[model samples]
Target chain A: MKVALDAMGGDHAPAVNIGGAKEALELYPSIEKIFLVGDEDAIRAECQKQGLSTTSPRIAIVHAPEVIGMAEPGAKTVRRKKQSSINVAMDLVKAGEADAFVSAGNTGAAVASATIKLRLIEGVDRAGIASGLPNEHGICHLLDAGANPEAKPEHLLVYAIMGSAFARHVLGVKHPKVGLMSNGEEDEKGTTFTKETFALLKGFADSGKAPFDFVGNVEGHDLFETQLDVVLCDGFTGNVVLKSCEATAKAMFKWLKKELTANAVRMIGAKIAKGAFVAVKERASAESYGGSPLLGVNGVVIIAHGGSTAVAVRNAIRVGMETVQHRVNPHIEATLQDVKR
Target chain B: MKVALDAMGGDHAPAVNIGGAKEALELYPSIEKIFLVGDEDAIRAECQKQGLSTTSPRIAIVHAPEVIGMAEPGAKTVRRKKQSSINVAMDLVKAGEADAFVSAGNTGAAVASATIKLRLIEGVDRAGIASGLPNEHGICHLLDAGANPEAKPEHLLVYAIMGSAFARHVLGVKHPKVGLMSNGEEDEKGTTFTKETFALLKGFADSGKAPFDFVGNVEGHDLFETQLDVVLCDGFTGNVVLKSCEATAKAMFKWLKKELTANAVRMIGAKIAKGAFVAVKERASAESYGGSPLLGVNGVVIIAHGGSTAVAVRNAIRVGMETVQHRVNPHIEATLQDVKR
Candidate 1:
């Protein structure tokens, strides 16, 4: 597979992205080439500093001088900066020069660039970000995690289809259990929008044509407690819920650490239990999953966290390759074609 | 202070309710009377079984013949079951016989009964539940925690005033710092509803007449990271964030325990560090705060968790007494009256 990565994306920029590209080249034999899209001078300097070969046949630098700021307005910045690395990288995917596009840059800009450049797949109303959350059973993907904020019930219906496809094909869930995010588990417990979405999903589930089992409604706690594969909600709610969970976990660990070091006895105990803490942290960290895929786009697009480390960037590239190898987009298209609606 | 307890409201029912009432009477010398609103026979039986004096004149059993099921529809059930314990307890407050009403029962039913019976306070359009979260600086109250789901921008403005009054008077903040919960901390990072609410709040803050310092937009992480006193949002978002945090905390502790007990060395360390865990758990426990106050109502209404233990019930009663003693409602009224808009 060929990939075009935004070399100047994320907080650490060229160094981490270059390091990730080198690691991906070493680990994955399937990668035929990687096009580093960014300022040529900076990419070369970072590549040299990292001890990576600048003349490697598998690596190529596509000079894109402009760089989008992390906090810049999404679509506007993408439109204004025609030579920006994110847009240039997306263009390569549109031209089929690369199999997938990866970025740890401005999330909004990455999303906008992908949608504008690649367009939407047939029968898809909007693209969504399928963010991964670690649950008891495994990983549960929450769709529309700040991609489509103002969505209709029909949009959510489309998200369920896309999310289910992503879970089954890329995430490898045999029969993905999809749920509508609501305030309560009861069928009647939701806002007007969720209620309407619930009706559509329930109807589709009753038709016996759905690829996944429809779990009527799920609460916020169900994200961790239930064995759900995919949970669907509008971007506004999904984003807030995802961030809240992250913050809570961070605060819990911080508090635990402070208390554990309060006395010598507890400190010694903490030393012995250090491995346990490290194990749990690695399991819970976003770096494990690497990136959230921007689903429903015509091409593969993976958006990594802006503060990604070199290891996280490597994993993100792996996720991008997996999406391509698994042919997740094709599965979504085929599944949508079977729907009567 | 006289308090009305919904003895038949919670999952534990009359048992925990009675046990809590006895404890509250012993703990607080200021409590003049406790009216246990439930079936007269059931309350008397539980009180007697718990070795409590029934004829001491301090504890009264009010006969509430009907009971509302936990899963019953909220407003409809409140209207249908006129003699339900929740309604009876709310009626006691509406009639000026009780200074506060406390329920560890169906949150929806309690909110409905309180809103219908006590009505909204002056200049308030809707009632909000100010749910507390233990943060780095102390506690940050999230407003509209499931009360006003479909809130307008003006309603959120009112929530800001009420939440500020709650934080300053009831939560003991000398000067409360309030924030609008959004997906990002930027000036333009929320849904249209939140953006409009931001404009209104900004206007109030700029006028130099607002009691609290409006801190613009804050993300979900700010709930734990920042020294915020109150964070305002619609009930739907607030409820989801709160439940997600609760679930995350539970999952973290469960995973920590499993990992810590995996080996002899770690198990020994876990035993030595058990005290630190207990201290942090207590610091983060909902039972410590006891209950969430349904603000913007005419009377003090505290809603405890449905599965509250006896200790939680006792704490709920204590919160009720504090809300009354602090004159929270009157302070809210006085603050709202000063606003020109």
Candidate 2:
């Protein structure tokens, strides 16, 4: 598979992206090619800085003049900066030169660029960003992570369908259980949007239009548990929960380190507890799931965080490859069609 | 201060409530009196079962005929069951016989009963439930935690003022920084409600109506950081984030235990890491916050979790006493008046 990587899109930029591309080429072997999209000279210099040469048969560069900052406005920046790294990388996916595109850049820009460049699948109103979080039972997929801040009930219904499709294809869940994120588990305990969405989901479940199990309402507390496979919500709530969890985990680790190093006895204890600490660290790391996938778009678009490291970038590339192999877009479109009919 | 304890409200009922009351009376020598509100026979029997005796100086029992189940509907149930433990406890607060009332009962019923029984402070449109979460920088308060699920922008502004007052008087943060929670940090990123709210908050800051620093917007990642002292949101989102954090912490601890007990080496390591583990456990535990206070009401009303223990109940009583001492209601009324004028 050929992947287009946004070489200048992340905090680590060309260095991490180039290093990850080199590693992907070395490990996958079957990954025939990678189009490193960024400014020519900068990309070349960073490749050398990382002790990597970009002259390999499997790797090449497609020079793009502009780079989108992580803080740039999504629609305005994406529309005006046509030759940006994200835009060019997505263009490669649209033109079928790359099976998937990966970027560790601004999530809003990535979503907007992908949707405008590659177009949405038929019957899909809006594209969503779906991220997988490690839960106590297993992994839970949270849909519409930040793509559409204010979504209608119809939009959420689409998220449920698309999320279910992604879970089945990527995680190998036979029949994903979908749940609506609400303040309370009862049907009457949510906002107007939630109430309307609940009724639509119930209709879908009763009619058996979708393949997944539509579990009623799941509260915020249910997110950490694998009570349902795909948890659906509007982007606003989903993004808040995602970022808060990340922040909390980071804060917990920082506090743990401080407490463990406070006294002589505890420092000695920390040495013996190293293995358990590693387990906890691994469980909290965001890179475990690589990047979130932009669902409902006509092609695969994977968005890693701007602060992604080499390992995260490499994981993102693998995710991109897997998404293409699993044919997630087609599956999503088919499910949407079934729901519509 | 005298506290009215609802002995019939929680899942554990008289056992936990009575035990908590006993602990409270024992722990806080400053507390002058306690009124155990529930069935007189059950309260007396449980006190005897624990081999604990409460003299007239420290404890008394108020007979109530009904108990609100955790699953009961809010408005109807609270009205019909006037003799319920929650109602009777509130009566104590209303009659000035007790400084405050504590209940490990249904949250909705408590909020409803409190709002109707202890009318809103003058010029305050709505009441909110504010819960404090421990953070590395300090404690962060999230208001409208689940009180008014369908809150308007004006209601959110009220929450901000009430939350700011709580942080100032109870949490002791001077000139607290208040933020409106939204999907993005940008002023224009949220829905109509958030956008209008952002403008209003900015106006308040410009006009010096609100004393706290009106930080423009905060994302979920700021929840644990010192970026904002208090976060303001409509009840729906606030409730979702609150529950999500709680559930995520619980799941993490559960995973940590299972992982630590997997092998003998790790088990021994865990034994040595007990101090560090306890620190992390205590930091994540919600009991430290005691319970959520229904702010904006004329009198002190605390809604403890239906699963609260003795430590939680005692801490809740302390919270009530502190609120009364701080004169939160009077301060709020004066602040609202100042804003209006």
Compute the lDDT of residue A78 as modeled in candidate 2: 93
lDDT of 1 by residue, A44-125 (tens): 9999999889798899999998999888888789999999999999999999999999999998899899989999989988
- Model 2 complex DockQ against the native: 0.66
TM-score of chain B of 2: 0.97
Please report, as a residue range, the 10-residue window in candidate 1 chain A with the lowest summed lDDT: A332-341
Candidate 1, residue A189: lDDT: 86
Model 2 local distance difference test score: 0.84
- For DockQ, the strongest prediction is 1
Model 1: residue B235 alpha-carbon error in angstroms: 0.7
Name the regions of candidate 1 deviating beyond 4 angstroms: none
TM-score of chain B of 1: 0.97
